[model samples]
Target chain A: MRKRWVIGILAALMVLLSFKKERLFTEPSGWPEAVYDFKRNPPDPAKIEIGRLLFYDPVLSRDSTISCGSCHLQYTAFAHVDHRLSHGISDRIGTRNAPALVNLAWARDFMWDGAVNHLDVQALAPIANPDEMDESIAHVVAKLQKTERYPALFYAAYGDSAIKTEYVLKSLSQFMLTFVSANSRYDRVKKGLDTFTAKEAKGYALFRTHCSSCHTEPLFTNQRYEYNGLPIDDSLQDWGRMRITRRSADSLRFKVPTLRNIEFSYPYMHDGRFKSLHQVLNHYASGIQQAPALPPSLQKGIPLSGSDKAELVAFLLTLTDREFLYNNAFSFRGR
Target chain B: MRFFLLYLLFSGVIAARCQEVNVRVTASFSGKPLLLESFYQLPGGDSIAFDGVRFYISDIALYLGDKRVYTEKDSYHLVDVSDEVTTHFRVSATQHFDKIVFHLGIDSATSTSGALGGDLDPGKGMFWTWQSGYINCKIEGRSNRCPTRHHDFSLHLGGYSGADLAIQEIALPVSPGDIVINLPLDKFLAAIDLRRQHTVMSPGPGAVALSKTLAALFEVSR
Candidate 1:
């Protein structure tokens, strides 16, 4: 009886310790409420870990040659910088650049075209894209079920060894929800913990004047599709949001991406046309393409001199959160 | 012991009052039952064979006159012609209903509400991966009139937004008994020209138009 009591108490203590060590999703101070409905699929440490594993696993691809981490590297703030268009399995080139994955909990829609309405189903796009993973969600679930490690992991996360599409998606969402990057120099300055340099301060002022309307603060995006006045690419002819909405007025409009990690997430824009921030500024300054439906702010274009462009670049660099970039928790872990 | 006996008696009475009505969906070519991969004569003198025919029926509610009498909880059914088991489902009704109302496709809200399970699950091949909406109805076949490669045609109807919303609510009056819903394939093929509009895999005007036609094709029988 005494031995049984000791074992039961030890088991209870282990449960308590596990609960204490479980990682949680935290909303950064002064940030708005997350758009994600956590009540539907609440966060669990085991589920998040399962998602992290699945994110790094190449089994999601047809040939197991590529993973989400392949395009979205942790060091680059989860955005691929090596290619203009995202290269998929078998080196197949996609149409648009892979946008950086940061503060996704606040995002209303996913993808450059806003094709995916919810984040839970966002991974479906790349997984089933012919140029990307070239695998279906059904096939991925089947593959995971056959894996010895996945059954155990899924059992721990979802309390069932049988893996389904819902569990796979919800777990991935849980892991991504933990990807909170609110420790950047700019964020610190906002919190009164640090101060921005003179150039950065000047750039911030300039950003508020010209760019902050679309790239709003606190989240760095207003989350609306706007026509940025880029002349249509002759070869691609991608209509952006118009393809999804099927409206003439929505033609050439794309979702405004978050400018949180602008330093590392290079090769910018929906198609990654501009290689540098200077080129982007130059586009705004004089290269705004003439269009009938262009927003008033870009109609005349922001007349920014070379010095102002330099200052903007300096301020953009302050948005980089090195802690998020180098965070080991998000990095690849071997099973 | 007396209270338990009384409770059991009350539950039995309640269970007896709730009648289980089986809903059987059948795809018919003209007046005859349709079979998959079997060639059938079209009105245009063209031969056609259905490779697949699947659709979603959701929000099933029974109505007495204009008022809803009973609504099935989580009422989403995937009726796949090839899989006869999926074509039949049971609903419990406490009272009699003259009209059966249901949406021919998933609603806009449910389509946008992240990963769903069961018949609405993405694994069922009903949900579109490239886009976020569910493929409300899928009809893939080969018609001799089709000009495509291998004389094939695929129509996946779905879109839950603005001008492209494809879901159609269908209400049919019926007698008080098990319901048998028939989708006349002849009428559907008669409405569309195979050569000009064979492939419609995306959510657009084609999908919405097809959905509208398909919605009107549902007929209820005792």
Candidate 2:
């Protein structure tokens, strides 16, 4: 019995010591542990600052005309506003909308089609896409290596003057991983520090009943694909998840995006079809097109009264964490 | 005195069990030495000049008869026809190994484990930027039969999913001492219907099918 007790105490001590280790991000109360393996890529303030510099620099693009910050701006919750589809270098139009970069540490896959399985490698897609940056990682590495500023920054972060692909990508992920948006009004309400208004409370109830299945709470996403009854665009016949899986059953299924900061990250959906929450609610209420792959819950259009729609919109607005949207720390650092 | 005797006996056994074994892989086209940037005739009577031929082989295991003898940890290798330095492995010796088993492509774990260095580095031209995964094998050349610009035929085979998994496990017989595994490119070229589909630069059913065919193109000799 004494030996067993000693072993138990040792195990408990180990668990405590592990918790005391440096975390990539703080786990918000009642939130699930982030999917990102913090143990491998531990967060460091120096690396985060370096990533911040890279995020805003247009040098990552082929012609030095566009940067990651071109689409992902801070005030707009890191989503490109005023464009249905994201605009890239040389006035090139991309096929899909750039989703908001909020709570990315909890994401299992990146992109609307779930192409990038790991966050560390996700930047490769945009950096190489012809419509986007149109620059290869090798070229980007060479560019960073040649830069007078980046070499020292990389050395400070990684203790090496030689800038490599792993350092570049991990640093970008490190910065993106720090974007935690858990201080919204809903969070405060959940913590009993504040209370929701009657309309927001009603909206919350309606959201739990209808929308919470796919857009689960806390993270506001179940991190899975679903056919949400949006008709295929005429010009761009993007068979969403099927493009990745090549399965007929997965056709038209796109990843369920987080509802956090929905108010600012406008022109919503994979293609940014609905520009407002009212239009989205209307689409859910009466605009669902009948399809074989459509989720059963969304097949029979959700019946929502005008008042319920208003209430649901109010609740969605509560998710807009102003602290996150206007966080000066995420803004562009002048080179 | 007895303890010292046992310790000496065990020390001798340990030393015997941990000798260094070397494995070398060599690439060829139609049983002839594969020379980069040299022209070679295909089965379809078309002369093909190769510019590059690189591929990854990982997860090496040695078997003595039916029982497992040795398995290398973190065993990923990039075999480029031009770069002879990468086609060698120095592993701890086993009691005996009659057969050597290895995958033709990187396993899913290493492929999805984010950015890597050395042979698997993206800068090495074996990685796809649009999609995150290592190109298991890359065969680029200018063929007379190719109808496209510059008559180039670039085939990059890699994927990591059901029905699209590109990694193929292959086992070949081996004897003691320095081992050389021959990968005859003609065997892979024999199965390719280059006329119909030659330029495969992305992951899909075509890449997966080609990876399986390439996996069978290896032969081990003493």
Candidate 3:
């Protein structure tokens, strides 16, 4: 009896330790509390697997030719490259660039205009957009119910075979919440595990002086709307946040995107007008369109010489996390 | 014998306190029951037919004059015109309430609470996909005066922010037993010109105006 009791306690301890080892999401050493309320929809391994499968599944679209992964690829830090604007169903072009899906667990709001208020409902925007998936949440649930694999997968995650809108959305969030990108070289340097070169150090100083106000560090975004002084595109005529708020004061403002993985996630800005980092830096230095909405920091413009631009680019490269880009866990494994 | 008599009395009091009341909601046009897809003559001489009519009724409570009495728990009912089962629900309330109070739409706190199940689910087609907010009241129909495609007029009224908060609270005096609430479609149609204002697919000043108009049409018949 004594031996049995000792063995039982050891087994319980082992199970507890293994459960801790298998946690999917862990906040980095010095990060603020995540805005996403995890207590409502805690991460489950089975649910994360379902979310990963759904992310790559084209059945979420009206036609089976598009998926969330089509616009958000894992290699380019989960952002679309090669296209200036987002390409959706039937080769339809979207007005805004497909923003990177990085460190989304920390985001208070989604989209360039802050239209989507929560991450749980964020997938609904692309699914229902005429230019994108063009599918309704109800229809998507029906499609998932009819699928051979989805019912079983949902059952595994939710303990029921009936696929529901809540289950589908919550599961997708579970997968995306695992997309924490805090393992970059800059993060390592911050931890004193690595050191920046002289040029990178100069660029870091420049970034701190000029860009840190809006693209605040750690998560790399202050998560606020700002007019970055880009001239209005006559063709698109997109009013950004003003369209959502219906206020003239918010006319040219867009959500400040994170600069993490800026090396790969280019064709930048809300409209994706700047093709390269040099063009973006040059625009900050010289190409700012004069406007009353322009932020006071960029009222004059960033003063960067040709060499300073190169140094800034070097610092930006340090923001890229190769482990996050190449993580096999995020990649599609075919059924 | 005395102990048994007291036990019986206590059980009777418990049963009376937990008594359930049924609330039935019905839609009508000019004092007649309105049927979906059936043409009705508008006061303005234009014909109208409803394809769908649905709205959320939430935060139901009972009162004695201005004093609070009882409030329903988890009180959200999606009254869809096509589904008679959704039009009525039971609420637990004791006798002696002079007034009934309820909101015509979901409260702002519940709207932003993120993904929910049951009647508030996104699968219900009452949630806007492009923006995050429950469509508190949706009325999709066709009118001869409407100049748009298929002569259709779709009004999805909902907003949970500063100027756009569209939920309307309605209080009605009642004597109590079972209650029946009637929504007159004629009053709703009389307030709007379908030719000029056909579509209100999103929340704004237009939706807020329509919500108020719709809220005023609800009446309780004892």
Candidate 4:
């Protein structure tokens, strides 16, 4: 009887030890707490791997020709490069440019229009969109269930071969929550390890004076929609936040994009009309269209000299974190 | 031996008497019972046919006078006129309660929490893809009075924010036996001008107004 008791206690200890794995995500120093409810879907190595596979697989699309990685490439900080607009399955063009995927665990809302509220459900938009994947969650689960590789993967992640939508979404969130970009030059300077050059420092001062109110620090975004005074696109007639809120006051307001990897994730703004930092600076300096919904700070437009523009661009480039762009862990592994 | 047998018999009687009760919901277009794809005449002399009618009922609580006795956990239910399997729910309570209260839509807690399973799942087509809230009520049908395509009207009502909150609490007097809740479609149509505002796909002022009308349409028969 004592031997049996000792064996039972040892087995229980082993079970407890198995559950106490090292933390997969660590909060960046001096940053706000993550908005994602990690308690509901705790991270596991197996689940994150499964989510990474799902992210790379084209089976998510209707024609099995487009995967999330097709639009979001890691080298460009997980944003689509070159194309002003996103290209989807069957070579179809999407309305908006794909935003960079970094530090998403801190975001309460996703998309330029703030359409998706949670990270777990953000994948659904791309999957169901006709121009994008156009595949249903139920169909995706069914397809995965038939695959020999996925059943084993699902069992390892969730302890069951039953591949449900909830598990799929949770796993995807687990993978995405690991995308923390806090290693930029700006971050290193703040941590007292590096000092900015004269031009970068001057640009940082200009940014604090002009752009810090909307694109606030350490996350580099206030996560609110603002009208930066871009004139309406005649063809698309995109009304930005008004499409979601339906309020005239919210017209032309778009969720401010993070500048963490601005060097690589170019073709800026909601429509990606500006291809270069020079064009974006010129828009702020002289091209702000007068509108009722325009932000008060940009009402008279940002006054910047030629050198000021160059300095601002120099500072913006310091935000590019090469560690994140070249991280091999986020890359696709062969089957 | 005799005493043990008597005790067992007494406990059995008590168990039977204190068993849980089921509340079955049935939809109707006025006084008549409603069936899927059933045609009914409006008071305005226009004919209408309902292809689907479903809504979420959640956060149920049993009140004994001023004191609360029972509250159900994970109590979200999607009641559909088309699905007989989800039309009924069991309410278990040891004590007597004079009234029961419930919300028309999911509470703010569940609405804010990301991706849930079963009835609250997005697979049920009750969730908004762009926004992050549950559709409180979905009423889809074809009416000759409607001027839109296929003469169809679809109202999906739910909101979580202030001034746009569509979830309403309703209290109904009840007894311990089986209960039947009636959702009167005719009264709901009469309350709103479907021609002027037939379709509401998202949460806003329009959805909140229709949800108020829907909240008043339920009558419990004990």
Candidate 5:
């Protein structure tokens, strides 16, 4: 009789646990809290579905041929893999690469140069660019409002029958904010659920010594712009941050990218100049360009030996979250 | 075809309302027409014709027959000035036509926030990506003065902090008889000169001057 009472109480506790709301965004253990405030537009299933539909819809483009997914593919963890620079409608080439869209809720700014400060407005950059989507927000809003389906969808999520830019953008951001990649092998090791191999442990130590200042641990990015001794390309002559500041000191200072999935997010950096991880390590080891403005860490070379490079590469591969990459929740589906 | 007909119908409705108010703004010149890459200079030059001109206006409140009818939220607008299209406005529902209030460009909060679309997109070449601020106002055109060829000029003017704050609110009343409510090229360029200050691109005293010039033009006629 006593055993039956205990069993009944335990089942009741299980029922209670199942009813708890699953967090829309969660901080992985041992990681810094996410930078995005989910409270602004809380996670709702309907809103995320609407955002997903818009993300895959080519109607946002001028010629109706390209969508955000055109450049950012789900197969490549929402990154453009075939080419370095992004291609827009009519095969129009852009100046920068379409970066991977993982863990973006933690990002403070958007674009390689950190030009866009707010996440809600990031979609507008590609939508309005003459060489990108080439459509105005007003024009896009009008287009969506004219559509018979979109108004109802917007109405379902937002209490208004009229679809506006804020709801469209904010909902899209909600879906993007849902992309969290914190279940990697590295994370497991941090959680003590698993142990790193001898090579991975050694590699992690080398990474800590050489890469952690800029590409910090846990989340794997300090989120600050830095100049890692890269020579200016003659054709583009792109001065990364100088144009924003008008101060010569900020010239060529591009935003430091996260190395969370560095094994797959290759052809790295703002320009996509390097094609392989071996080449990236080589640049850090010995090819660091000398400049008055280079970051302090690369003032001298990273000075890694050939074996050390191999081990560092091995450890970076540990950062790849296969489950996150293959997750069906982020896959593209025709709405 | 039907949309065009409706638009035409609405245009006349707006015109009649403006006529009831009888407000007019002059197309005067303080120096020369607001030149590209430069500021106001002495007048008496060749005709200043513009190819493309665009700016924004916000906070539109309309009055009807003795009562306030409609008003817009923030009410920002991008006014494209060329030879073809001119004179646009909203109609009031009420009978009392008395006053209107508005501002040019983005408000203070909208200006400071980062990475926005619409009138604030960087691709428009209006906002500076590196500096993390909007150009606020952009006016550029060819100049036939003692400068460079084509006299390339840009007005990348905007600021949010310090003494260089760009946002300002202005209110003007509706006057009587055939209002016209013309934001003509002449009225906007009254304080500008092509020869001396042909190109005033980017922020400084040049943008503030243009803003002040825009404020005085909203004169209420007796």
Candidate 6:
């Protein structure tokens, strides 16, 4: 028993050494503690590179027609611009708009109705959705394994070259998670290196009063599902949050969108109903739809005037995130 | 003097680590060898055999008295059910354990951030894309009640936040020499009365209900 005890102690030290794996991510100073707890499974550079390759690869879709980047373009904060709703493989139109994939680590929930709860698995929905990538996970894994490029890439990223479902999804998630939208002009201003112009600052004040309650600052979202007062369109009739919960009370409670990088993340709202900030401001000012799920803050329909609208638009533009848009580090590699 | 004491301590640690014992952990669903169909009983008894089933067992630990022995390097295994008859797990640890504890899924840190490859890779069907989360539990099988005509059910169950959390802890014994803990199929009966339902494929109240039963299989005996 004593000998066994000594052996036990030594074995534990080995595990301690193994578990002492290096942390691949750092909580950038002044940023909130990440919603993703990297301590349990640390991020590795190898995995991130693999994820980047997959992100740009079209192998994730059926018929080899679409990649995740198809709808989530980098120039537009990963939000699609060609259509009001997302268009996927075989030209299938989805019911809801594809929200910009920005600063997702800070998000509380995912999807218009918050159907998904974790970031690693979010890709499964689009990959498997018939109206989207239209590909099955098993089929995709086989396809990836057969691809000459993927095997080499997987070997470089992960020591073993075997292409399985878990590695593919995790690698893609690594790339998406690193697509952090933290380098905007607003970020610089927040860091105290710069100041907002008069129009921008004035607009900022109006934003704080009229919209900050839901589309909060910094991260620019509370990350809760809220009824933003969007009236249901007769043609699409997308019910937003109600579809997930089957609760009448949640008839239209869509996940609150981040106002960060709003300038580039337009046509706003769940359905991409508005093409410009002015229209969004107009809806906020007086076009709120009345319903039980209408957020308590917007029930009064923000009482801003024409000048206020102009000021709000200027403030929204401050969130353009120029560095995020043009950052060469995030650009297509070997393109 | 400090260096001398440190050398003595380090030597003892290395010596202890050199000694090891092997333990086997076999877990199956119901009384039968686990087929994806018999296991995942979702809402409304729509039972179906799945195309696949995958899960991870992490943080296997050994406790001898107050001290704990850990699996240093590769302590996780993604059990694939394709050709293997039993989900056989033979672990060699550098510790004499009086007890053992492990997790049924990869811990929280690995589920988010950075990219992962191999068993933890996202390309694996176990991960979710729309919600950007890992599906720690995957069960696909045939069921009559499924809306998909194949009579097939794909239940990807795992969520960390809110009420949908599925991670659970299991504790067992290391046995003085060789210890084998069996997570038999009957535990499914312990967890659910399959007569009521056979299908649960998404994240909600149903997944949590089933995972509770799954966590009850750990035993601390030698």
The most accurate candidate by DockQ is 1
Please give, for residues B68-147, the per-residue lDDT of candidate 4 as tens digits: 98898888899997798898999887677878889899877777788788888776778777677789999999999999
Q: Write the per-residue lDDT of candidate 3 for residues B73-192, one digit (tens) a residue.
A: 888889997899999898877656878899998888788777888888987988888889889998889998899999999988999887999999999888768888889888888888
TM-scores for all candidates: the values are 0.93, 0.92, 0.95, 0.92, 0.73, 0.71
- TM-score of chain B, candidates 1 onward in order: 0.92, 0.90, 0.95, 0.93, 0.63, 0.69
Could you tell me the lDDT of residue A213 within candidate 6?
86
The candidates' interface RMSDs, in order, read 0.7, 1.2, 0.8, 1.3, 5.3, 4.4
Candidate 1: how large is its RMSD? 4.8
Q: Residue pairs in steric clash, candidate 1?
A: none
- Tens-place lDDT per residue, model 6, A254-322, is 888887777777777888889988898888888998988887788899998898888888877878877
- Residues A1-335 of candidate 5 have per-residue lDDT tens digits of 99999999999987764343246566666667677766566678788888888898888988788888898876666778757788887778888778888888788777877767677778878888877898876677778899889999889898887777778888788788878888889988888888889898889999999999999777688888788998888988889876654568888888888787777776687778888899999999988998878888899989898989989988998998988888877778666
Mind giving the per-residue lDDT tens digits that candidate 3 earns over A1-335?
99999999999998876565347788887899889888788888898899999999999999888999999999888889978899999999999999999999899889999988899999999999999999898999999999888999888778899889999999899899899899999999999999999999999999999999999989899999999989999999998999889989899999999999999998899999999999999999999998777999999999999999999999999999999999888998996
TM-score of chain A of each: 0.93, 0.94, 0.94, 0.93, 0.92, 0.90
Error of 1 at B181 (Å): 1.1
Query: Of the pair 2 and 5, which is ahead by lDDT?
Result: 2
Error of 1 at B42 (Å): 1.2
Here the TM-score of candidate 4's chain B is: 0.93
Tell me what fraction of the real C-alpha contacts between chains A and B each candidate also makes.
Answer: 0.85, 0.72, 0.83, 0.52, 0.15, 0.52
Ranking by TM-score: 3, 1, 2, 4, 5, 6
lDDT at position B121, candidate 1: 87
Candidate 6's chain A scores what TM-score? Answer: 0.90
Docking class of 4: medium
Give the per-residue lDDT digits (tens) of candidate 2, residues A16-110: 75664435467797889889887778788888888889899898899999999999988888999978898998999999999999999899888
DockQ of 6: 0.25
- Relative to the true structure, how large is the alpha-carbon lDDT of every model? 0.91, 0.87, 0.90, 0.87, 0.70, 0.71
TM-score of chain A of 3: 0.94
